[model samples]
Target: MDSQSRVFAAILTESGREYTGNENPQRLKVQAVDRQILNNRVQEVQVTGTAEDCCPADRVSVRVSVGHSKDSVNEVTNSVSRRLEYILQVVRQHGASEKDTSVRRFLHREADKYHMDAEVLITFSDFEKMERVRSVLLEKLAKSVCVGTPQFYHSAECLSLMRRRACVSAVENAQQKACEVSQLLGQTLGHPFLVREEETREWKNEDEEDGGRCQNATRLPHPSQIPTITVSSQVSVSFTFRDISKKKPQ
Candidate 1:
């Protein structure tokens, strides 16, 4: 071939590889790399939030005890039995079933005189009923019956509800924070891409430990004063970023 013809042929051969099928695999590889880079550019925001709340007790228990001393064993036994029976009858009449009541009795000699002591523990779901039973026993029996103060506590259902409330509150706080941050960044907040409960804690109100001036304790928070349980939760949430222009009209 002539020199000019040879130069033109060399140029054609050098540029031909780009259109040939042999370069297809390399082109596909470059496109795959570009897709990976685009995936890495996807925007997301992560935030953490925490919340705490208190739950009131739902059940109460009361204890009643009676004791008597006499010169003879028969006298002490009869006296104690009569009072014990009366107490049990009063408890049963106040909406308390056999399953809700427990009884214990003791008979012994102290200083040559026979002595007897009996106790009844009653569980009440209705606070009104518990108060009524306590009042009646103290009124009719006078100093002969000793009625203890009410002890309040939370039931399983109450505890479950409290836990759910705390967790949901934490999640809501996180979502609110994410929305505000997204607005500041000129982006719209999108649906949550990931949600996780990072931690949870629970404790009883301890006013006594803090010199009786804690926030949850204006007064002494004993079992008789409707003690409260505090529950706290922390959550981490990740949300995808959306375009502000694409946000729905409000």
Candidate 2:
């Protein structure tokens, strides 16, 4: 293959949410403040992937969130840090026994004066183990921290995997497409002498809001009313055309 051997590539993205129980007392409170927190957590868990496997580089981002009073930033920060530390300890205890399990990245944010968010990224050899890690974190967070449940999202990885797989499929599809185009133009398709791929990333806020009579909202009977969260990813892809030649009259 020459340096200019052209081939076509494309990207595909996908998203999924890891579900768990929400047992926070504040989540079930009839007050609007508590209701907002519940809604936020539910929306966070409901995120869905745009493509199936691969994600674009630029679209790789995560959102972390927590609910607290305006003056509680310091307290919230310390609480979140301790919670994460405990999570890391859990990974060290259980994950160390296995391979390809470690912390990839961790982030913290204050969406406003009243809310604190922590985004934690953990990597494992496979999805099954990743699920286990999520479960472990949820348990630890519930017991160790007074904050809402901690959620995990494979935002970029979801899209990245989709893109990688799509690229492979796109090559096959592009080859067939090129062949059809060549035949239609009364020409023969030459071997791909050049191939290139282009991609872009976009950020979007997936927000969910409910407007209804507060008095009518159903109330959870228990404090352990498992919180719901949604995680999602977005991206775009383009494939370029390449190499053309004419066939002799036959």
Candidate 3:
């Protein structure tokens, strides 16, 4: 057997996007950008799980964005606060399960003379039932906050939890493929001589402002879904091949 070996590397990826909107140009632009990023980075795979049509059954977390003139921060805050309260009242009226609904994060910033942004995150267990809540909020903002639709995202913690399983599966798949290739090379595969697994997360535009100066504001599709975590594995495998000269005499 000689100490020479040939290795090959392969990768697999998966992704998803969830959103709902009319034919608004702005919305379409956002959707297109989101699709482009995902298509370029992700591979098609059968992901089991209903597209998160509504928030999860457990408490769903939501982010609300509000903006106003810098000089009007106080006014904007007051108005937005009142509007939120009204929204809460409406949710209560609609039988929202308040036990799971609460404020999660808040941010306020001054961008310019005519730009002040405030953001609030609300968490609730029953997101599917929030249609009334959204309607009430829109109605409240009609006369006050000059903001667009409040974007919703599955919490980071939730995503990490969900992806962990997928990551494991991807790792196993990579190993199997590596072994298959080793077998096809006419050699007995040995322990991995070297293995490298890498994952890269890219967003459309993480530097965009979100109601305020968001460090990385990615305008993902309605589901605020990220392209599947691309788990790439590079393995340098060593295998033993019998030397023809050393073959046993029949």
lDDT of candidate 3 over 37-123, digit per residue (tens): 533542211111111111222333445555555455566556556656665676667675566455432445555443444445455
lDDT of each: 0.71, 0.37, 0.41
Provide the TM-score for each candidate, comma-separated.
0.67, 0.31, 0.39
* Global Cα RMSD, each model: 17.6, 25.7, 20.6
> lDDT by residue for model 2 over 96-213, one digit each (tens)?
4333333333334545554454444444434344445545554555433322122223445555565566444445555555565445534445555444443323332332232111
- Which regions of candidate 1 fall more than 4 Å away from where they truly are? 1-39, 71-75, 186-193, 203-225, 242-250
Q: Ten residues in a row with the worst lDDT in model 3?
A: 44-53
Indicate which candidate wins on lDDT: 1
Cα deviation at 201, candidate 2, in Å, is 4.4
- Off-target runs (Cα >4 Å) in candidate 2 are 1-93, 96-144, 155-160, 201-250
Best by TM-score: 1
Better of 1 and 3 by lDDT: 1
What are the per-model numbers of colliding residue pairs? 0, 43, 6
Clashing pairs in 1: none
In order of TM-score, best first, we have 1, 3, 2
For model 1, residues 87-136, the per-residue Cα lDDT tens digits are 99988888799998999989989998999988888888887888888878
